[model samples]
Target chain A: MMATKKRTVEVELSTSGIDSQGRPTRVPLVVDEQGRPVPMEPTLTLEPDMKDEHMLINIGPQHPATHGVLRLVLELDGETVVRCVPHIGYLHCGFEKIGEYRQYNQIIPWTDREDYLNSIGNNVAFALGAERLFGIEITERCKVLRVIAMELSRIISHLVWAGTTSIDIGAFTPFLWMFQERENVYNLLEGWVGARLTTTATRVGGMAADIPAGWTDGLSNFLRTFPRTLDEVDRILTRNAIWVGRTVGLGVMTAEEATNHGLSGAMIRASGVDYDVRKDFPYLDYETYDFDVPVGTAGDVYDRYLVRLEEMRQSVRILEQALARLPDGPVNIDDPRVILPPKSKAMSGIESMIHHFKLVMEGPRPPVGECYVAVESPKGEKGYYMVSDGTSKPVRWRIRPPSFVNLSAIPRMVEGHLLADVIAINASIDIVMGEIDR
Target chain B: MTNFSAAPVGSRAPRDVVPASPRDVPRLGGPQNPSADALREQFGDVVPRVDVCWGETTVLIDATRVLDVVRWLHDDEGQSYDYLVDITAVEYRDMERPIEMVWHLRSLPYRRFLRLKAEMQKDQPLVVSSIWPVYKGADWLERECWDMFGIRFEGHPDLRRILMWEDYKEGFPLRKDFPLRGRFSRSEQLSQALAANPEARYSMEELSIVDAFQDLPADVRERLAGGEQPGE
Candidate 1:
């Protein structure tokens, strides 16, 4: 076949280069047969100069990426965040104010709602603090059981954090995998505590009930199988190029800054400060368990991810040790003031019936004193500061919520990063607005 | 190679120092923390009372010298309480009793926990020096304390309400006199919420950052400057 003659038109380049927004202002156009350049489909209009002008944007009091009712007002210079102002309290129920009215045991349910992901952990923590105020030592079995509950709570919290964080960074597979493992853990919690999310499984001196018969088999199965899911997630995300690109250099807080800002849990440990409440200040025999506290050097979002992942492994190790050392004894203390008599005894003996009635009607009272007991919660150093005026109800009850304090440092972390990076940094902090607003 | 798994250089906690749970801790008057003695030696009369409860030491300092004591504790090489665990205030049920401000400080290296408290009389202005200068973490803590207990931290950069909206009119919710149900009736609370402008969710400082409210009329600006109160 004969080749047709090739026809080519020489087109001139655009006049101006780029606009303020870095978009090309004009493009080359083809000419008509008369060598007259055809008017380009009306030249692209240049965007107004936005160089020196700043923009204000609000994220959410209801947006999903915020994790809960956390609103952030950000001022942007171009695409970079100049300043960030976080507005919380949409979920505020005045947990502390209500605690002053209810008895110690009644306050356990309130703790569940604050950091709902770690409800069982908060129960253990509140019970520990109240027991301290009442000046009572829990049974040895109770201590070991509380340790198991705390470790399990930590696993649940870290899984949720990882799952939601993965979703935030545009990865769906890890979220599903992580949450499947979380559901398994939740099932274990349900078997033990009878509730999934709000497990008020503790009393002032003991748990609500001892572990049901053969419950250890379920826990042992979880301990054996949960890490395989974690390993799968690590394989999917740990070395992912996109994940590393989005998180490696974002929201860096040096050790000094992290410590000064009161950032805790995986946040500070990611910054290279080896200050774990479990190791630095021991409680509930956390020191007795043999497990490593994961520390990271970068202090960035990726480091936080790595730290939390390692923490889950460490939690698994602690759970294994706790399972091996599980003892046989009453979970509640022997003291009659706090523990109720047997139902048969109360029905038969008149004195036992009166004691039961008085104990039920009037709550146990602590002496005139105050105590602040802090625990290594999944979020960080969760403390409960309580004061007694020799009354059935506490004079004052305060929750030193770690998420609240950790979230407070968001403005600093998100200041210089891009607008999209604010979400990554916020997710890395692992804030539960319930705790912050409470 | 961003040191993802690498440990920190010169980490705060040493491997040799192993912490154990406190067993058989006395109900009252246990052994005192070393920092307590050091604080007494450093500022003899400023620290008037030291009490031990549940193996935790509480050192009461004069209200005026809190900043001084905290700065010393932070800067002094010997007593490096670099981490501020928490800052909260407690009001006793007895109306006559003074309110107490509690500061929980931890020295990561020394493995010490000390509680510093300052008491303010009910009649007093309830002003205490802010520790934000020493620890930046004190920013929201002091703000929350003021928001809840109505105790002012004199020099916090942004001393506004944290857990509550800025223009909340009901008295401090955590005060002993504040009712459990709240100061206002349910109907009143509902009306207030309905009347409140959703646009005012952004505080003046935030709005002023971009001058977004500059286009509003003078009366609105005056009202906003007057503190964004509805039905004024």
Candidate 2:
């Protein structure tokens, strides 16, 4: 049986009145070096043999656009894709299998590596999962801190995104601007977390420690300048003839297609959906903060790009709001089961020291229930599913890594687009293979 | 790697405190049970029994009926479970049943999700969920199910080793019964061979048993202890 054909979600302009001869006088679909759709010459025409029989091209496992280790088998007829099959598990280290063996705290560092670019987000997702498992509550101060850290993470992740995506799409100015902001973010985060990429900084109930002094001022300065730099990128790319020509209507997805595919984050927002986990399902005090969910009319590579660019601005707005309300109380949950006693107390009291040693040697166990806790990361809804058997180690732990699901939609987005546009569409989606393959 | 070891693979199975079947577990007629008449009423003759837990209703169906139920869950009824959320497995080894295949379905329409399970024996298990048809997302999840657990998705377009390199005959490593490691038994076989022949395959010193005890060829006979290559 033949499968139903879906609509094109790639961004393109509405048709203009044709002049005289009726040869698609305005802009039409572009074709590339291999005759696939190109931004300049978008068309879906098949070769003679291709017209009769389809061709299947496996796009990744090594292709640059895949982000990391993902493989896509694209069955095409000339440039129009007939079917796209994704082969995953190339990076499945059996993380779920491994989680069953280690203590609850041992799993925090591992989450950081899943989405290396958004380690704070990954850490919080796990942190929230354990918090839910034990029914631990966070103080108002920690809630504000979470908002600040998560917002900073979102900005940093998107900054890397803007730079790396521009790097991919043959643009260099925006690349420099985005990276300068990223370097500032890196300095601020490192000052607070000690390590950068795999910072196991966020413990279960609260942060690892209090924020270093003056870090808030540094973050505010970064947030204040970020919008101007973003404006610079916006002025350069949003209206530039070539930039618009290349991205404005390329690799579009619509609301229906995106919803059906379970697309989320800026990718879905780019296609005009109004779903933001932070807003729709507010956790970690997001509802208290004021921010907007950026939406786009077209779900094209360009639309996704604009959505993310706008999202970074909104994230900055949130950071500024959170910074104003930054609290000064204890950050970590004070539960004896989840946290170690104070060193002074441990030194004076035998019970306190024994409890401290036990907490360090063997982590606290969660109850025998399964819970899947999700948080909105810069990329999308990053969630962790934990299964406990009344033990310190989890019975099973599975990551609903957004990259894994998001990468599945690549072939559909790039199939008819020009090969060069493939890079742009991939960058707009913002996938990290470590998370994808995990 | 393991901080704590569990019962051996061959040891007694883990037991579940079997609760009384939810009034919904419809009984069929024939010892070779035919379709449950009551079940056919709520759902069609083919519609499987739907069970509810935590407000989420899981529709248990035969693997052959996967396409129909999945299609109904997504299109025919607008559940728009158009999104294939996740696919994972469960091992029921210590129980009377040893294996269960789980498919987690999510519907963007209601923002609700459901879990489906196909209980099967360890020997031969079969299920037909043509992923390319339902949520194109299931294509990879289905491949992974086959790759790690060796579960077969009957209509899967492409099924092959996803993680382990080819030529690996070891059983699905995730199966509770599969050995955590397989090296120990391999050494026992080598030891028995050495007992039979001190020079098992051949001594490093000998070209051949004194059959044709002629001076051994340089290639076959041992040279120096550690001096190294002939090129030297």
Candidate 3:
């Protein structure tokens, strides 16, 4: 049997306006011979002093190398970038506006979506900020678990950064190897929190749950094997001729310039600024933990790589200490007003059930005050500034997203450099659009 | 094991009571907190309040002299707040001046953090001098404040929307009066766009399913459109 043919429609073109001399006076309803609409040419006006060699190009909002929806408008003079303007907000989710309507404890899951890579760190930052306003100190066990989760998330984040940055610099082998380690870390985290990425593993006053069985063994096993893989990847990319040549002196920013531009984390440390919020501000009992803050002398892409590599090692050190000192007690605080009652108690006792109902129905009311808590996230200093109005919901929940601030310094870093170097510089900064546009 | 009975109910645990480790303690104090004291001493009339919370100092200065005070804080010898950590704003709907701009600054050498606050009227032309000249980091931060809160930053090199698109004509999203779902105009525009595209029949539905259906063979596509299984 023969198949039926599809119908086609044809539209006529209107070429009505013409001069009496059979010559077109003005172009009216211009169309190609095939009846396709033809667009008019755009007019261009240039000054006499303007050079013809200068050209403008847009880099993203859809380009692969932009990391996310980040767009950059580049003015190029030959192969060098004359000026670069970053246009962001393609991923804006109105996190702050949405957060204002959410209760204190309910905001944890939302915080995870902000910086999806370091969701654990973002959760801890938000919880700590809210806890400060509530004037509630978490238990030692909770603090230790938070440190472990945060350091693991840091390791995972830095691994992704190293892997992606190496890929950006034309090394694919390291990317594969680094992701292997990241997968192991994710497996370990999945065992603990049931979710790998965007893990809302923390609560306002404590962790969502105690560490699962054999989770530590998995962490230790991964930690033992991670360093060997890290060193292998390091040997592959750290001193490779192409990697070194591509990243050694590219995107150099001085310590002064870094600080003036609000750069933090490895971005500032690579510029020889000895600042780490874990050491300087010391939330979650980080003051007692023993680890060295890695400092870099040059603020180039290579220095940032070295700084981040050393930072992952430092995170391992912190993780080991936290695991060893992990206390044996309740993860949540004893306060019934803040934490939910145990299920056994809630099911059996009236007071416990009532407390659970009240805590779940109306979240803990913090005093009317404001506090800003920053954590040394892998990208930079991720902070949460919250203002309370003696209610369950916050009056203002402002996220001090480090990627948003770090991405701002791109134009300064890319100016006067080859266009190819922009990718390396952007990768070295390691910005996540989720956080930047939150 | 540490004693839990002696501790007051809901009080902080004695976590820091452990003997200090032999690690070198970095000097965290600088010139007796110079930012608050020196600014109060110098700009006494302009500086209204100095609050110390959780070991971080916040100085509330007059709205007009915010740039001058930040510049002074940046250049002063004792209080060299060379780093601009964050810039944000809070809105109070019931207050006389509803919008308050907050600046978080830090001195790297001293490891001290200082917050500077200035209030502005809620109406249009909410102008405050830009601190871009003092710290280049304020460029995007000021633009973000302008974009989200509709506060204008005077003298900003490029004071445009940082988070929202240029074509977004709806009112600021972060304002107190703005609805959480979205402004009505945005939904109207969305419906208008949907109405304008007749060929986009499956655009509002599950887009992944539409994409998969588009990839199928023509007969299969027709079968799916007719609500029939691929293999009966």
Q: Pick by DockQ: which candidate is best? A: 1
Error of 3 at A62 (Å): 1.3
A255-333: candidate 1 lDDT, tens digit per residue: 9999999889989999988888998789988888878888888899999999888888889999999999999988998
Deviation in Å, model 3, residue A312 alpha carbon: 0.9
- Per-residue C-alpha lDDT of model 3 across residues A128-232, encoded as one tens digit per residue: 888877877788898888899889889989989988888887889988998998999888888888998988988888888899877889888887888887678
What TM-score does the A-chain of candidate 1 achieve? 0.90
Second chain only: TM-score per model? 0.82, 0.56, 0.67
List candidate 2 stretches off by more than 4 Å: A1-66, A70-92, B1-69, B76-82, B92-100, B113-132, B161-169, B177-232
Give a tens-digit lDDT track for model 2, residues B109-161.
44455666566666665455665576666766676667667788877766766
CAPRI classification of candidate 2 = incorrect
TM-score of model 3 relative to the true fold? 0.82
Q: lDDT for each of the candidates?
A: 0.87, 0.67, 0.80
Colliding residue pairs in candidate 3: none
Q: Candidate 1, which CAPRI tier?
A: acceptable
Q: What are the chain A TM-scores for all the models, listed individually?
A: 0.90, 0.85, 0.88
